[model samples]
Target: MSQTNNRDGSNKRSRILSSDVYRQRENQSSTNVAQTQSGLIIDNETALSSEIIKEQLNSVDDIITQAIIEVPTKHLLYVKELGDNLFVSLSTKII
Candidate 1:
């Protein structure tokens, strides 16, 4: 690998290792993917009807379900959940 030295005698890597965070570090650019989004929260009273979630639950069932509805990306996707409780919204714009 070649190294370039600056006028002040500092050096940097010729090629940077690209990952989720450092991929755009060259332009000092920032990305929104690393940021966590605040999603909608609802309860029993506010729960809407859906064929995707076809099950009855009590208060503590902590049900989490989703369907592959059409997104702007033209591909289908669903929510990613930590368990039966927490859910992460999935969308193409999240990038």
Candidate 2:
């Protein structure tokens, strides 16, 4: 199994109150990044000027749009599985 480390470099595991939601958000964020990066080239290609391209790239709406495009529909299932595993681990600790 894969393990993640805390900021302190300790092997301790931490649980969040709403990890399912958090994971979903994280997946979405990553998807958005991928989308934005892929779209940057196309967006830049159509710009009349370098300044315009830079301005569009910097806009919050454009960023969000790219994210919306890149977000995969399949990530929902993966996030759910992660949440279930986390719940099981937490329950095991409690017992």
Model 2 over residues 6-40: C-alpha lDDT tens digits?
Answer: 54344222344356556775566643242333354
TM-score on alpha carbons, each prediction: 0.14, 0.21
Candidate 1 RMSD to the real structure: 22.3
Best-fitting candidate, scored by lDDT: 2
Residue-pair clashes per candidate, as listed?
0, 1
- What is the C-alpha local distance difference test score of candidate 1? 0.38
Give lDDT tens digits, candidate 1, residues 5-36: 45224422333233433555423433322322
Q: What ranges in model 2 sit over 4 Å off?
A: 1-47, 62-95
Note the Cα lDDT for every prediction shown.
Answer: 0.38, 0.53
lDDT, residue 34, candidate 2:
29
In the predicted model 1, the residue pairs found to clash are: none
Query: How accurate locally is residue 70 in candidate 2, as Cα lDDT from 0 to 100?
Result: 48
